[model samples]
Target: MKPFLSIITATFNNEKTLEETINSILNQKYTDFEYIIVDGKSTDNTTAIIKKYEPIFKQKNISFKWISEIDTGIYNAWNKGLKIATGNWISFLGSDDVYLDNALDKYVKKIIEEKNADFVYSKVKLINNNKEVIYIVSDTWKWNQFKRYMKIAHVGAFHNRKYFDTYGIFDESYKISGDYELLLRAKSCLKTTFINEFTAEMKDGGVSNKNVFKAFKEVKKAKINTAGISTIVAFFDFYFSLFKYYLSTFVKKLIK
Candidate 1:
C-alpha cells in the first residue's frame, strides 16, 4: 500500500529552520504522504531534530525515511531521495520552507481531478530572513517563457513518478539549476497544471539566491544542454538575468 505522495527535503546544516519545516509537514491536513529527509552529513543539530520527530511520524502512522551522508551537493542528495521514493507523485520542500495547513489537501484534490497532468505547481509565499512576508512568486507554465527563464516556482511542486521513470532524475552536474534542467529535459511534451493558490512559504537566501551569478551560468548551460537552445541565446539570457539580479539587490540595499 504505497502512498499517493512523497515529500522530500534535502538539507545541510539547516538546524535553525529544519524543526519548523518538520512541524509544518506534521501539521498537514492531508496526512497520507510519506516523508524523506536527505542530510548532507550536517554538522549541526539537524539529525537530532529529525530523530526527535521520528517517533511522532511513527505514532501517526506516516511513513518517514531519512539518510545522512557525504554528498556532492543538494542535487546529489535529492537524487538519493528519488531512488527510494515509493509514492505515485513526489515533491521537494526546502528545509527552511513550510507548507500551508491546507496545502497538501488542495494539491491532492487537484491531482485527482487532473488525471492527465504530470507536473503540478502552485504559488509560494516568499519570506525574508526575518520571516517577514516579501511576496508571492509563481507563474503559469508557458514553454516559451520557461525557455527564456524558469517561470514556475519549483518549491512544493508535484512531480509525478512517471516523470522520473520517463525523463530520469536530476542531473548531478548542476549545483543550482538541476531542478530547472530536469524539467527542461521534458521539453514541449511535459504536461503541467497550475493551482492559483499559495501552497508553501519559502524562506529567502537559499544557495540559488546567494550564488546568483553561478546559478545563472548553470541555468544557461541547462538551457543549452537540455532544451537545445543556442549558446548565444543562453548567453544573452544569463547576462540579462545577472544584470537584473544585481539591480534588484542594489535596490534592496538602498531601501534597507
Candidate 2:
C-alpha cells in the first residue's frame, strides 16, 4: 500500500537540530507515512547525523530515503523531494522544526476525514533559540487572504500531491517566498481547510526571517504575479507584519 503522507525536509548544515526533526517524524504514532530528506551537501556533521539514523529507521520499519548533494537553494531541494515523493499528501518541514506530539496522528485523521480538501493548514508554535515558546501563530485566515500575507505556515501546512501535478513545483528562483507563492497559486484551483490544531514547532530565525529585505521583495513579486494583489497591498502587509513583530517584542519587554 502506498503511504498516505510524506514529510520532506530540506537542509544545508543543520546537524544540531536535524536529529530532533527526524526523530519527531519517526516517532509518529500514525505509521503510514514516509520521510524524505534533501541535504545541500553540508560540510558539517549533518550527513553524519543522517547516517546515524539509518539503522534506526530500518529497525523501526520506517520507509525513509535521503540524499545530500549541491542544490540551488531550499526551494530547489524541496522540488527534488517532490519529484520523488509518492505520498497522497506531502508536508514540508525545515531542519530546525519538529512536529507536535500528536501531529501525525491528527493530520492523518484530518486528511482522511477531509479527503476532498486540497490543502490543510494548522497553527504553529514558534520557539526561539533559547527553546522557549515565544508565540503561537495560528491567526485565523480565510482562503482569500493569501493575496496579502503568508497566512499558512508552511511548516504546518500539507499539500495534496495532485495539486503539484496540476499547479507545479516550487519556483526555485525564490529562496524565501516560493512556498507562499505556491499557496497563492493553489487558491485558484484547490479546496482548503484548516485543522484547529497546533501541528509543529518552528524554531525562530528561519531563512525567511533572516533575509527580511529579500523575503519581502520576493513576496511582493509573488503577490503581483501569482495572486494579483496590488504592490501597494503587498507592501502594506509586509510592513504591517514587521511592525506587529517589533511591537509585540517591545510589549513583551515592557511586561518583563
Candidate 3:
C-alpha cells in the first residue's frame, strides 16, 4: 500500500542533529510514509549516520532514498525531493528539526475527517541545541489573516500532491524564504485546514535566522511577487515586519 504522506528532509553538514531528526520520523506512530533526504555534499559524518540506520528503516518497511550532490541551494534540494516523493501529501522536515510523536497520525486522521482540505497547517515548538523547548508558536490563520503575519511555519504544514500539480514547486530563486513564497501561492489557490496541535519541533539557528538581512530582502521580494497584495500594502507589511523583528529582539534581550 502506498503511504499517505511524504516527508522530505534537506541537509548539508548537519551531523550533530541529523540522527535525532531522522529518529523522530522513524519512530512516528504513523507507519505509512515515505522519507527522502537530500544532502548537499557534506564533508561531515552525516552520510555515515544515515547509513547506520539503513537496517532499521528496512525493518520498518520505510521507503528511504538519499542523494548527496552539490545543489544550487536549499530550495533546489527541496524541489528535488518533491519531484521524487510518491505519497499523497507532501511536507518538508529540515534535517535539524523533529516532528512531534504521532504527528503524522493526527494529520492523516484530520485529512480523512475533513475530506476537502487541500492544505493543512499546525502549531510548532521552537527548541535550542540542548533540546530545551524555548517557545511554542501557536498562531493559526486563514489566508486573510496570514497576510498580516506568517504564523505557519514550513515544518507544521502539509499539502496534497495535487497542490504541486497545479501551482508548481518551490521557487529556486529564493534562498532564504522560498518556503514563504510557496505557502503564499498555496494559500491563494487552496483552502487550508489549521489543526490546533503542535506538529513539529523546529531547531533554532536556521539559514533564515542566521542571515537576517538577506532573508528580509527575499521575503520582501516574495511578498511582491507571490502575494497579490498591492505595492502599498506590501510596503506597509515590510515596515511592520521590520518593526516586529526589532521588537522581538528587544523582548528576547529583556527576558535574558
Candidate 4:
C-alpha cells in the first residue's frame, strides 16, 4: 500500500499568499495525502481564505484541519499540526511556498519504489516577489556528504513519521535554526534518499534572508546551545558559514 503524506502548513497573517499556497496543495496530482493548516490566530483574512477552500478539500476527500489560535511560534504551530497528522510521512510547506507541478506524485512514487528510504528530498527553485527565478539550489548531498554541508531544504524534504518518533520534533527552543538542528539529528539516525528533482519553489524574503545578520547570529547561538559544541569550534563554524554565504551570493550574481 502507498503511504499517506501529511503536508503541514503554518501561517499567520499571510492573506497576500494564503490562497495560492492552498491551491498548490489542492491541485496536487497525488491523492494519498492529508493537508493540515495551523494558523496563529491571524487578525487578517487568513481564516476566511481557509474556510473558502473547505469545500474543495471535502470534494477531494482530503483529510484537512485548520486551527486559528495563538501559539508560541512557527515551530509550536508545527508541533500542533504534527500531533494530529495521521500520515505515514510528513512534510512542511511554508505559507509563501508552493510545490512544483506533480511534486507530490513524484515524491510519493519515489518513496514507494524505494521502500528502504527513511526520508526523501529534492532541489528547490527560489523565486522573488515579482515571481522571477532567483536561483536553483540543487540536491548535492548523500547521507555522508550531508554532515559537511547543510544541503537539505526543509521545504523540499519529506520524512517518514517514524523518524520523528525515533528522533523528535523541531526544537522549540530555537526561534531560528531549529529546522537545521532537527535535520542534523534526523540525518544522524535515518537513511535518506535524494530525488535529484526540483520538489518545490520557495518565495524570496524568507525570515532568514529578511534579517540575514540577526538570523545568522541566532543560528550560530542555537547550534552551540543545542549541539553543545566548544565555543571556539562554534565560532569557526559561524565565521565559515558567513564566508560561504558571501561566496554563494557572489556566485549567484555571477551566474545571473
Please list the Cα RMSD from the true structure of every candidate, rounded to 1 decimal place.
Answer: 1.7, 2.4, 2.1, 2.9
Ten contiguous residues with the weakest lDDT in model 4: 140-149
Give lDDT per model, in order. 0.90, 0.84, 0.82, 0.81
Q: State the lDDT of candidate 3 residue by residue for 28-63, as single tens digits.
A: 988788889999999999989888888888899988
Ranked by TM-score, top first:
1, 3, 2, 4
Q: Clashes in candidate 3: how many?
A: 0
Query: Candidate 2, residues 1-256: lDDT per residue as tens digits?
Result: 3338888999999988999999888877887777899999999999999999999988888778899999999999999998888888999998999998888878777778888777888889899898899878776657566578776667857888888888899998898889888878866565877778898999977443458767878888898888888778878877887778668768978999
Please give the clash total of every predicted structure, in order: 0, 0, 0, 0
Model 2 TM-score on a 0 to 1 scale: 0.90
* Top-TM-score structure, candidate number: 1
Any idea what lDDT model 4 has?
Answer: 0.81
TM-score of model 3 (CA atoms) = 0.92
Candidate 4 Cα misplacement greater than 4 A, ranges: 142-145, 206-210, 221-230, 243-256
Off by over 4 Å in 2: 1-3, 206-210, 238-256
Q: Per-residue lDDT of 1-256 in model 4, one digit per residue for the tens? A: 8888999999999999988888888888887899999999999999999999999999999988888899898889999999999998899999999988899988988888877766788888899998899778776556454544456677847888877887789878766566766766754555777777887999986545556665566666755665555678767776787888879878978999
Residue 215 local lDDT, model 3: 76
Error of 2 at 109 (Å): 0.8
Question: Which scores better on TM-score, 1 or 3?
Answer: 1
Q: Candidate 2: lDDT over CA atoms?
A: 0.84
